[model samples]
Target: MASLKSLTKTLGGKDIWMLTLGKGDAESKPAIAVVGGVEGSHLLSVEMALRFAEGIISDHSDVLDNTTFYVFPNMSPDAYEQYFAALKWERSGNARPTDDDRDGRLNEDPFDDLDGNGMITWMRVEDPTGDWITHPADSRIMIKADRSKGEKGMYKVFTEGRDNDLDGTFNEDGEGGIHFRKNLTYEYPYFVAGSGEHSVSELENRALLDMLYTKWNLYGVFTFGPGNNLSSPWRYNRAGASKRVVTSILNDDAGLNKYLSDIYNETVSLKNAPDSGEQGGDFLQWAYFHFGRLSVGTPGWWVPTVKDEEGQAANKDKNREVNFLRWAEQEGLTNYWVDWKEVNHPDFPNQKVEVGGIAPFVMNNPPLAKIGDAARNHTDFIVKMAKMQANVQLVNLKTEAVGKGMTRITVDVYNGGTLPTHTEMGTRSRWLQPVKVELSLGNGQELISGRKIQTLRSLDGDASVQFTWLVKGSGTVKIQAGASHAGVDSQTVNLK
Candidate 1:
């Protein structure tokens, strides 16, 4: 049976619900934590996580018996509410108030609907010294001038808001606080906007991490957010991985990530998936580097390439905004773009300023119903992943009697699953369980050889390590192997 628990209330008093969707006790089984709403700007990720939870509960209950799922439906509920709020922009933080510009002011220069459309869009100003120009193919989109191509810029772009605080920066300090994506312990960005005063300083950030720490069997974490390492796997770089700060994935876990990425691409098969490379402190990177788990993440959805009249997909290397406009027109998607119109502004009286561009949240988040295949495919992929978790078994138990009352007992600790017991980072972090092979002898029994408890770091998939013990004057003895996440298996033997 599935159960929902609130981790804590967001600053807006929204309940951040964590759902344990599976059979029996979730903590007792190996689990994958499906996290959504890492960034409130990505509303589609929230829909994906919710639909997966619903799909798993209704259709894939049988898979839950072996695998538990901890579903975090939303992490930044405070900012997420802005989607339905009166004035909406792409907000990424929680409700806690902070000087986003760190200028000793709180949201004093927030976004203003210059067009009064009740939505936030871009503001472009025509100026000779500007570094932006209209896209060659689509005048509705803006692109940076490439001096190498002899393109000259004729406009400057900014968010749709004037300098309310007269800081000469438009909408630098927005409503809300730390971005959960940036307020993580791993590679925490210092003094950066939306990175928070310090890492893990926000309530939701602290609460989510604390809850994750308690889940002993959570070996895999799936984060749905801005960064992507799923559709296209990253390569392992020894030099970067060996850095004192560990800037890249370890060699061992890197291969695993590549394998999983292949499976993800095969399962989802979403075309034109955007690979937003990792920045510091995001959940996708933190889960692997800090949490020491098999972590993978993606945006789950992206704008597909528009096809020509002959049904051939256009080259994706084109300007993203122009590409999006073409796809939107082809798909009959409307109201997502704001046409440029001259607006009277206080910031600049002489320059011609216009407010209009692609609407916020429309680029990252598609129509909710468009992701049905994504949810179903992800569900199937995760279910397959659940069945692949490391399983420990005490196999090949044998006992031989010597000429005297002494007897020898032997057993192999084997991992019979696709994934190894511990990830390369998991072993290095020393956070996960270290395997144990223990021998418990009867009152009359005495150990003559081998460690009473043998401990080591890791076990590869389809691999086994043997442990032998010589007992003196033994009656009965019990041999147990393994620890929490990898699982423990025991064997009982009678000695003569």
Candidate 2:
């Protein structure tokens, strides 16, 4: 923490931090940014991020020679603190007051612990018109009643609280304000709850974007959030994806996503992972679609499905709550769920009501004791990713003496790694700086052919672009080729 740079203050006055680790000329080297706490309730994300930074500096310091790292450990400090509050619940927004219901009042109907429990659980009321039903296998878990399957609705589930305003909505407004993950620029969900008044409206979002906009050397962005584009690559939809607004991952970028996903699976051992994609205005999509960088995201941890005596995995129905409860039971995790108990409610008379369900943050995050191992696995994965970044090199140089003391120099600038110097969309958008080739000639030397500096759009993997420069009167000339994100390289030539 001492080595981190405080980039800026969020709207809630929390410091947004960045720890840059690298060797000489880090600004010009290829970089990977590891961000966490994009979703405030995901406390494991913050822990994993911090562990990665600590592990890199303590164990994998050698990897920083050619690679730079920017680790943001906690992007939503205000909302993350709720995990330690006296009354705990899964919170995703920051610490700003918001009129979530738009009922001419601010936070008037916030969540209340009606049962006097330390946690905010669910409240289920027995109503024939409700759309929820208890899971047949595990009564503790609840699922939406499938009307098409002839399943009759038996209950209405709501966050545990009373509608203080009598608006008929339960706990719609809460203490925490705008959600950090829901306030990005790409595919901004306008006018939606938690999407904010406009995209990038929050101080935290603006601060992070400002830093990214200035750091042109960043080639990849790795976020620890709800999205899992790293485990399962996003599928491309030609028509809908290629629209002017661009809803899907670009075809070329989707290929890269698959390539990286294979690397992730090989490096990490966790399996039976859930498939989750980008919601509108998420950091993962914003990194690629708007920031023009190769972006990857993961939750860092999830419970693997438990197996039965016959060696088959339990909960084949794919109900998250049911599967989570079964897994918790198999693991002897008794504290995750609270038994439902009848409770009196002010809003309803002569109706059956109860407050109980899975405790907050347990389903999304593993127990604190298990996070150390998970963090170690993620740290290794991130280091592996850094090794695959674009490594540009200058090769195949030839010098020829032309007529009347003119020397013609030729060389090929190549990308030697599997990844391209820039994403296809990045090249198309022209946001990332193109690879720059420059020649430093000695005193009184004049260039006769090629420009002093040449910018190439992009260099594909194992691909090269040849450049020729004709100069007059040079004893020794130094030529350099690369971009901030591509990793620069240089060669010295003696024109005799």
Candidate 3:
């Protein structure tokens, strides 16, 4: 409940751990990693992450030992502070400032809420030659001008602001950090204004790599983010609505793709974003390609409905608006209005100002009123992911008698999960721990030639890990394979 900054230890000082959470334990069950607030403005992410961690501790401690929940609520805490402090420049990055507009001035003239309505509403500048006109069907929603239809443009939309820089630009270069998501190495859109050329703020990325990747036992990973690349609800080629970006990323791994489809209700689609080519820097891609394990990128929240017009046409479909209304009504939130409002804008003093849109406060960032419900819902999903990560498998165990005093034993280990014993991306990027193979023997009188076996690293799902042991005399031997976070399984065989 205290400020995130208050939950840290003295690690050579300077104050940290304000960005991380969860109490660690040694006993293994099913472990889950909860990541949220990668984008600073997404306050709901941080709130829900914390709320779920507490919920698990308070309500589900029985499974706590079996599952270690690693919670990083605010990956960009520095950026979030700007939001709570009412500073207009709250993007994904940390407190570091960048020249957003490249006009030689850096974050000097950011957008501001001149009206003091506590919202960074858009500013409409009335222009005779503007390229946008108010929608006739819904004045609340603006539509691009149709020159063919002889509809003249009326206004230019701008983020709520004045000519702070005096350069005649409304919000060219605001403040605080480039888009961190754009920083991913995966087919990251190049020459983009905000994607940092290099790994600028390595704080969060490095921490994730060091902690999760380095843990050799972390074989499977499910990350929650904005894009639900794995959710394949329907057909492809739907433009911005379809998951074209994720399709190309997993094209090579058809087996894993199929498995993910089954697990995620087949909502996962395979398609690439038309603009950004294939990416090599994305964390999930790196996890699979480099670490040689199963990994997934997921959007934490899903709007139940996809469209209103489509649903109405079918008469049996659900609309995104309906789902939003359900959430709004349930939480008693009235921040969003379908109706239009009349307000004079400095830029477009004559044009009407209507504030009904995506309802940034509710849909974009659910208020604290709904935080508990949201956190509980997501906690279950994370728990399910943990259950799926456990590769508790019995591959093979064989024993044969060679002679009066010699016998041989062999064991085959298989990782049934999509992820192997270690994350491929983690290993490739030097971000994960090497896969570990351990064999334990009970009775030892005369040690044979090959008694102990271990593997430094491992391949991905469906791959077999083999171990062998020789004995001087006929006896029984037990073997166990253990993976971090994935849990452990064992088997025994008798030799003649």
Candidate 4:
């Protein structure tokens, strides 16, 4: 926090911050934002973000010459403190008091650590009509009973607690408020639990959006969260992803997503990854679908699946919990799970109740010791992505004498990077500034062939647009072409 404060101003109070690193010149340059703590439970996300910032400032500051970086680390500090609290649980939300249950009360029924283990685990009640059963391979893990396979239901699972409000639900309402990831506007899941009253209703969400709306130079966004568009691109849904409203990634942007995914796979070598997809009302989707930028996201780390004796990746058919447990055991991690113990429940006086299961924040966050390597790999990937931003340059200059003191100046403006000057959706939305080409003439000189300034909607990778300008009576003229995100380039032409 001290380092960030020394670098940039604190926005939206102490909870939100913005750091801009670059040449600090008048010319607008392309920028990429690295956001962390989109989910409060994922502590590793915050670590990765901070490490990226430190790494760039300490080692890779040269990239800032042409590129600007906006590092927003730890967006959910209020809820993140719960990880170090006396009684810890995987929490996602802010400090604001919320009536999540709609019972006209705030935080009425919070979690209770019944076993005094200082961690909130699961509570299982043995009932004939329950729908959950223990996993066949690992009894510590639970899976829903498959009714179609004639599997008999055995136990009902719930969060560890009693019904504080007598409403027949345990720990339905907690101390934590709105979840930042669940409060975005794009495809907002209305009336959903933890989504808040409306889209962008929270202070952090609105403040971040406000900052982004003013930054016209931002070409891409990278978020460290549960959404994993970086690891695997979303399947194309022509109708849902490409409508005028655009609930899915636009076809062109989807291609970029896949391109970035391939780059990520080549850079990061951790295999047997878990499924990480976009959930509704997430920051990642909102950045692409609504803000109109190339957005990518990932959890940064996941437990690698256990290997078999045949030197092959095992657990192809195993569920996430089962695989995670086996991997944890192989790694000699004993603190991840709490053994089941008998407990008395107020709701079910005569029923057999037990409290135990996988501990919170274990599956999502790896040990702190392993964070450095992951951070370094992710930093390398980000630097590679930065090098791929569209760099517009003016080339192929030619001048001809056309008589009567008139000259024709022609040049090709090209995009030299892998990404386009503007995303397809960005061009269609007309939200991004177009590539503007301007010519500076001498006194009493007038352009006869082309306008003083011309705008192009977009330019694809390795693509160029030709421009010709005829001016009457000019010693020398200057031409400049580019946009905020394309990195402007200028050239001087002589007409003798």
List per-prediction Cα lDDT, in the order shown: 0.85, 0.86, 0.54, 0.84
Model 4, span 192-239: residue lDDT tens: 777889988888888788888888899999999888887778666899
Off by over 4 Å in 1: 308-317
lDDT per residue (tens digit) for residues 96-116 in model 3: 567766777788777766556
Deviation in Å, model 2, residue 419 alpha carbon: 1.5
Candidate 3: lDDT over CA atoms?
0.54
Candidate 1 — what's its lDDT?
0.85
User: Candidate 4: minimum summed lDDT over ten consecutive residues — where?
Assistant: 1-10
**Model 4 Cα displacement at 301 (Å)?**
0.6
Q: Could you say which candidate leads in lDDT?
A: 2
Encode model 2's per-residue lDDT on 1-496: one tens digit a residue.
1257888887778899988888877777789999999999989889989899889988898998888888888889888989899999999888788888887788888889988879999999999999989877667778889989999989999999999888888888767588888899887888777889888888888888898888989999999988898778887889866688777778888898898888888878778788664578889888888888999999998988765446444455777788888788888887799889999998988999999999999998898888888888888988888887887899999999988889999999999987899998788678999998999988988889998888888888899999999989958899998888988899998884
| Residue 19 CA displacement from its true place in model 4, Å | 2.7
Full ranking by lDDT: 2, 1, 4, 3
Candidate 1 similarity to native, TM-score: 0.96
Alpha-carbon lDDT of model 4: 0.84
Error (Å) of candidate 1 at residue 121 is 0.3
TM-score to native of every candidate shown:
0.96, 0.96, 0.71, 0.95
Error of 3 at 393 (Å): 5.5
